[model samples]
Target: MIRPDSFVPSARLAPSADALLFIFQEGRLLLREDGTLPQGHVEDFSVDLVNPLGMLDGRPVFGARLVGEVPTGFMLRPLRGVYGTLSEDLFGLAGYAMQIVEWDRTHRFCGACATPTVRSERETSKVCPNCGLTAYPRVAPVVMVLVTRGEGRDRELLLARGPHFAPGMYSALAGFVEPSETLEHACHREVREEVGVEITGLRYRFSQPWPFPHSLMIAFTAEYAGGDLALQPEEIEDAGWYRVGSLPTLPPPFSIARRLIETVAQGE
Candidate 1:
C-alpha cells in the first residue's frame, strides 16, 4: 500500500539524480518500450514543460507534458493499462503525478473570475490574482459495494456490468458520492440506484486512489437485503448472482473490485 508519508509535497522545482520523470501527452503516460519510467534530468528532456510534483524517497520528482508527436526511445501508454505491470511504488507515483498535472492544467484560469491564475510559491495550489481565489487538486469520492446473498455452499455474489464495461466483465456496484451525503448513505443509495436492490451489513473494507481523472474508490461488502434485480438501463447492462465455483469474467487483479471479490470468494 502507498502511504501518505511516501510523498512529501513541495513547491520547489529542484532536479536531482534518481529523479523519476512522469511525462504525459494528452493524458497518456510516457514510458520506454520496456514499460518502465524513462529516467533523465529535467534539462535532458524539456524543462519548460516540467512541473514539480514533490519529493519521493528524498528525491525530487517531476511531471512533464509532451504535446504532439511521439518522441524517440519512448512510447505513450494509457495510465490504466500500466497498472498491474508497473511496480507498486512507481504506479502510485504516476497516479500522483497525473492528478497534479490535471489539476494544474484545468485550473489555469480562475472559476470565480475570468482572470488567469498563477501557481502558489508556498503550496500546491493555483491562486487568482484579481479575486484571490485558490484552487487545489480535486479528489472525487466514490463508493463501491460487493453485494452477496445466501451462505455456505449456496452463497452467491451479485455482480453487475455497466454498459460501458468491456464485453462480459462484471464487478461490484459503484457510484460517486453526492453532495451532503455520507459515505454510508452513498453506499446504500448507489446500490439501490444502480441495481434496484437494498443492501445491509455494510462493512468498510478499503480504499484505492483511482486516478482516471481523479477518484478515491472506497470499497465495502454488503449483504443483499431485499428487492429483485432491476438493472438501471442507463448504467447497468447485465446483473446476476453467481455461485463461488462458477463466475464470469472479472475485473483485472489490480483493481479493488477484483480484490473485494477475491476476499469473499476465498472466504478471507
Candidate 2:
C-alpha cells in the first residue's frame, strides 16, 4: 500500500529537466529532426513544429492537436504507449504536461467568476485576474472494487460491459466520488447503481495515478450482500455474475481495475 507521495525525493533528473519542451497546435508533442528531443534545445527554437499525435509502429502517440496554427506533414495518433518503450520517462512526463497544459488552456476562462485566468508560472496552476482565485491540477477521484466470496465458492465477481466498449469486454464497477462523500461510499453507490447489489465488509486494496486528464483510482474489496441483480439502463448495457472458474474478458493489464480483480481471484 505504498502511496505515491511516500516516495522520497532523490537526486533524480526529471524528464522535463533541461529537456526540450514543445506544445503542438493540435495537442501533440513535436519531435526533433532526430526524434529524440521533443522539439529544440530546452530553450530557443526556430522552425515551426507540427501538430502532435501520430502512430509509430502502429501504436497510438499523442502530443498532437496544437492550440494554434497546424503544421504541415504532421501525423496524428493516440496518446498511449507501452511502458519501457521508446522514451518511457519522456512520454510519461509529456503525458502529464499535456494533460496540465490542455486543462489550463481550456479552463483559462474561470467558470466560477468568468474572469480571465493567467498561468501561475510558479508551478502547475492558474490564477484568475479578477477574482484572484487560483486553480491547481484537478484530479478527479474514482473508486473501483473487487467483490469476492469465500474460496471455492461458486460465486463470481461482478463485471459489466458498456455498450460503448468493445464487445465482450468487461470492466469492474467504478464511479466518481461526489463532494462530501467518502471513497467507500462512492464504491458502494457505484455497485448499487450499476448492478443493483449491496456491498459490505469494505477493505482498501490498492490505487493508481491515472492521468487521463487526472483521476486517482482508489481500489477496494467488498462482500456482496444478497439482492436482485438488475442493470441500470443507459449506464450499463450488460452485466452478470460470471463465475471465477470461467471469468469473462477482463480489462487490459495496465489498468488497476484488472489488477484488483486478479488479486482477489488469486485468493489474496
Candidate 3:
C-alpha cells in the first residue's frame, strides 16, 4: 500500500526563484499538454514563478500555466486524479494555484464594508481596502473514521459510497468538522449523516495534509454502536459492514482516508 508519508514534491531548494504562472484565457486555465509545465530554465518569457513543489527526473518542475481556451478549461481537468502518474505532482501544484486564483476571484469585494479588496504583496494573501482584513490561503479540517465492531469473528469496519463517487468505490466515513464541535463529535456526526449509523470509542489514528485546495484530513478509529445502515439520501448511495480480514476497494494511497483504513485492517 502506498502511504501518504512517502509522497513527495521536488522544488524545495530554490524557494526564491519559483513562480505561479497564470495561463489566462480571459481568465481560466488552459488544458492542452495537460501535464507539461513550461520548461522555465530553458525557456525565455517565463510568466511568473510558484513555490517549488519538487523535482521530476532530476529536472526541477515548477507550477506553471499555458495559453488555452477559457470555457473548456474548468471542465477539462478533474480536481483529484485517481491513479498515480508523473502528472500527480504537477496536478497538485496546479490545484494549489487554482485555489489561490479562486479565492482572489471570489473575494474581490470586502465583506466588512463592501469595498474592493486587493491582492497583498505579502504572498498568497489578500487585503480588504475598507477594513484592512487580511485573508490567507484557507485550509479546512476534516475527520474520517474507520468504525469497527464485533469481538472476534464478527469484527467489521463500516464503509460507504456516495452518489458523487465512481462505481464500486467505497471509502471511510468522512466530513468536515463544524464550528464549535470537537473531533470526536465530528466523527460521530459524519457517520450519522453519511451512513445513518452511530459510533463510539473514537481514537485518533493519523493525519495528512491534503492540499487539494487546502484540507487537513484527520483519521480516527471507533467502535460501532447500535444503528441500522441507512444511506443518507442526499449524500450517500450505499453503505455496509465489511469483515475486518477482507475489504473492498479503497481510495488511492495519497488520501489519509485510505491509509487509516488500511492501518487498522492490518492490525497495526
Which has the greatest TM-score? 1
RMSD (Cα, Å) for all candidates, in order, is 1.8, 6.7, 5.6
Q: Poorest 10 consecutive residues of model 3 by lDDT?
A: 1-10
lDDT per residue as tens, model 2, 1-268: 1122222212222323343454543444554433443543332333232222222332223232354433454433334532333354455555555665567667768878998887664555678989888887688899987766545657588788887877788878888899999997888889898888898999998887676657888999898877877998877898877777788888766678888888877777
lDDT string, candidate 3, 142-243, tens digits: 998889987665678888887888778889888898999998888898888888878878899888766555677888999988898878888778888898
Number of the predicted model whose lDDT against the real structure is largest = 1
Candidate 1 lDDT tens digits, 72-138: 8888898888877688888878888888888877888899997999988988788999999999889
Q: Give lDDT for model 1.
A: 0.86
TM-score of candidate 3 on Cα atoms, chains taken together: 0.72
Better of 1 and 2 by lDDT: 1
**Per-model TM values vs. the true structure:** 0.94, 0.75, 0.72
* Alpha-carbon shift of residue 207 in model 3 (angstroms): 2.2
